[model samples]
Target: MNGTEYRDHRLFKGTVTERGIIDYILSLDESLRLNYNAYQTIVFTVTHRKPNLFRSFIHEKQRGLSAKMDQALKTFRQSEIAIVNALSYDYSNGLVEGINNKIKIIKRTAHGYRNFSNFRNRIFIEYKLLETKTAA
Candidate 1:
């Protein structure tokens, strides 16, 4: 599987980073297979602030949150259609969303980290340790 990064400046807070993660998942070679006969279906999940700050403000100033969400949903749906047509497989954002939540929890519990490299290493070590414990 290949993982790349997606970045968008317009998105609130961690949106750019989250999109990067999704891009990474979508880049996996086997992610395109419909039946996943040769590979597994790739799932993309992301967790972001509930009531995205940008959206909240936009809604307050514009039609409403529902309208903003509807527009965003439509755009997302269109993007998914395009991606599915090109890849011949289904893509999911649920997993990515979950992972984002998990990351947030971890960060909060630990009271955050001083450096991104340290954070990355900690995450890697935690996963590796979990894998070892599970395998044992």
Candidate 2:
């Protein structure tokens, strides 16, 4: 599910108290829950900012929480700086991936291309059409 759906249902984050079980889960330790909310916020944030606050908070939180939480935090701790850097990394395989997907579609649907030159021309034509479409 998407963000809103998960927050409204799975996270038990809503005004309605019809779900007593969910309420109990959240009320177990309200402060811990608040800390987790902050942690999750840091994890989900997309900006190119280093998570200095998050790194410190995780250390403090790991001391207080369970072994299960410690395990997860351990993984994050190992890649702490990398996680922060991921926020604004420009390098991506998305363009190549998109072209690969289009190439696969062309290979699957088209027939009678007996030579590699014919297949190459078809792929070039596809890119040319895409370029024109984007230019317009």
Candidate 3:
């Protein structure tokens, strides 16, 4: 599923009365339910734009856990600054990515244009830039 769908999934956004189904799964020995609540909190943080809470959650929960989770938390910690910036800023590369995707599709369908100039012109036309007028 895409990011929005995954974010809205039942496993991530459980009812107020109880935690998600993911929290019910136990490890091999069944001695402990996996501490996947961290993931739930992360979903909450990003969805709600709570960067401070994200920092706090990482600081408080990054210890005495399964090896996999520990590594995941470490990776989160490493990118903590970037994550905060993402949450704090409204900036996004989505428009650029969309343009690039369109260009890629055009290139694939055209089966390789004869020259770079032709390909560049095709991209400009796809974006509705018909022509450039020079100042007299």
Query: Over 4 Å off in model 3, which ranges?
Result: 1-34, 61-64, 131-136
Error of 3 at 127 (Å): 0.5
RMSD of each: 21.9, 7.4, 7.9
C-alpha-based local distance difference test score of model 3: 0.74
TM-score of every model versus the real structure: 0.29, 0.51, 0.71
Tens digit of per-residue lDDT, candidate 1, span 31-111: 332223211212221122222332333233232234445565456455654544444435667888987887787799889
Best by TM-score: 3
Best-fitting candidate, scored by lDDT: 3
lDDT of candidate 2 over 22-67, digit per residue (tens): 4566589865776566556566554435466666755664445555
Q: Candidate 2 at 73: error in angstroms?
A: 3.2
lDDT of each: 0.48, 0.65, 0.74
The sequence of per-residue lDDT tens digits that candidate 3 reaches over residues 81-133 is 99999998999999999998999999999999999998998888888896755
